[model samples]
Target: MIMSHPDSIPLNQVLPIFLQVLPLKEDYEESTAVYGCICNLVLSSNSHILSFVPQLVSVFAQVAVSPVESHEVKVHIGRAFSHLISIYGHQIQPLLGNLSPAHANALAAIAP
Candidate 1:
């Protein structure tokens, strides 16, 4: 819904829902969907989603390094992460700096 009709759906409401589902251990498919939505939001150039970037970064870092997650999930996160870096590299660097060494390294390994 967000990807197809971003104007009809307010991000403030949808983002909270995404944040809640993204960290679950039992739902890689749903988490992958969320990452896809986030990647779409980033590519769409929606400035409203910018405020949620920090939280997304944290979650993306966690998911990227999770041993139980599927390789497909990591690829989705990598897409989102790459979009984030290309568009928000300056802001993202500091946030990445705040991640644990393992998390930061995982993200770096996926960087394009």
Candidate 2:
């Protein structure tokens, strides 16, 4: 649905839902899927996502640095960061310093 017409998806509605759910530790698999969905949505609709970059980046950083987060989840988070950086490196560059050491390392590993 989002892929077909990314702009049509109501980010204001969906993002709040994702932000509430994605940080929970109880549903790792579901959270991973949600992260993937977010990555795809941003890739498909960069312009629309630009407005929420700070929030998205913060969530990704949190997930990437979480000590108890699953390896699979971390992989997805890394990929998401890599894609975001690839698409918006200039805008996101300054925010990199704000990330935790672990999160910065994960991003550096996958970033070009």
Candidate 3:
């Protein structure tokens, strides 16, 4: 059996940190940076991100649609969503139906 790289932390470990931090209202800057990092990680190692796709999509959608979030954060979320779709278009299809209207709209704005 082929082993994944030792330096690549398991999704189980990395996801919890994202789940904890992404929803906080008090740290927009930190959360946005974390969101960008997560997107980059997903782009670089999509297989590792597969199990957490639903949560990842939802968190980004939420951020993208949030009126209180800064424009910069929303733009980052939109870019992240675009990157994800470019890499994993089919994988994200089923989850799109489950998104809230605002989330769907946000995604639609960037859809190809």
Candidate 4:
């Protein structure tokens, strides 16, 4: 429902809350749901989220290297990364480099 009307939503307030979900690692369903929302939000034509891409990349790196995360969740994250790369192209490469080798490789491997 939120993704369906991404343009109307205030990204700044909601996105941070969603970003918190991955680190907490308390609820699998919640984590996956957050990833799903992210995947949808990235694909949506909401330019506002572009400002949050760095933050999103940081969190995605965290998730990519998270030992306990499910493959399904990583798949969702991969799709989000792919969408970001499609939109931002080379701009994303630098951020990926700042990550740990394994994390960077994991994310790179996931994206096209």
Candidate 5:
């Protein structure tokens, strides 16, 4: 229901695109397309995507730690994390308490 807003559409669509990239190791072109979309989501307005932060970080963390994920995908996730930290870290920190202190501390440091 909350995702029905026009402003949220771009952010809402990012997860599926990221999924497409995460599972496809051999398709550089396709992966790049999805990663670009994810980058857009990262930079999108937090008010539009505030509810989706946990989903975004969980997916990115899953991919970030996955050996099966492509290096390119991992790189996108890293960038996404940076964007999330810089843009929405305060909003996302509670959801990320499951992560180690060092990583959580780093994210907290980057958060507004």
Candidate 6:
């Protein structure tokens, strides 16, 4: 059941609208607001609804490269990873292997 999580589309399908509001210089607070929504989804175990953590980790990687993503947005992603590692420390190993040094380094910092 855990492995089948990424087949879910509503999660990815919903993010672009929030992403689009950026490149055009929209409200600064919007990204954090949307991030909070995603955070709620995560804390409630909806994050576990993914096929694997790697796919969601990829989304964070994308945000790292996103020019329109604010520093706050990037921080939001980092915080989300921190939350994940707190409850699911074992899952970070594969995700760290897949991420770039910069991103992987941040994950390391979250380790207990």
Weakest lDDT window of 10 consecutive positions for candidate 6:
1-10
Give the lDDT of residue 24 in candidate 4: 44
Among these predictions, the greatest lDDT belongs to 1
Candidate 6 Cα outliers beyond 4 Å, as residue runs: 1-30, 47-52, 65-67, 106-112
| TM-score, prediction 1 | 0.83
- Judge candidate 5 at residue 43 and give its lDDT: 61
Name the lDDT value of residue 42 in candidate 1.
Answer: 69
Candidate 4 residue lDDT tens string, 1-112: 5667775777778777766664546676577767777777777746666678887888887888888878888888888888888889899988988888988887877665
Q: Which window of ten consecutive residues has the lowest lDDT sum in model 3?
A: 1-10
RMSD for each of the candidates:
1.8, 2.8, 4.9, 2.0, 6.4, 7.2
Q: What residue runs in model 4 are displaced by over 4 Å at the alpha carbon?
A: 20-22
lDDT of each: 0.78, 0.70, 0.68, 0.77, 0.57, 0.57
Clashes of each: 0, 0, 0, 0, 0, 3
Better of 1 and 5 by lDDT: 1
Question: Candidate 2, which ten residues in sequence have the lowest lDDT sum?
Answer: 103-112
Model 6: per-residue lDDT, tens digit, 19-107?
44432245645666665555455655564333335655656665566667777667767777666777678876777788788766644
lDDT of 5 by residue, 43-90 (tens): 664454445667666656655554555676666667767777776647
Compare the candidates by TM-score and give the number of the best one.
Answer: 1
Q: What lDDT tens digits, residue by residue, belong to model 3 across residues 1-112?
A: 0123424666667666657666557766676566666766665655666567788788877776777777766666677677777877887888888997788888667444
TM values, all candidates: 0.83, 0.72, 0.73, 0.83, 0.55, 0.54
Point out the higher-scoring one by TM-score: 1 or 6. 1
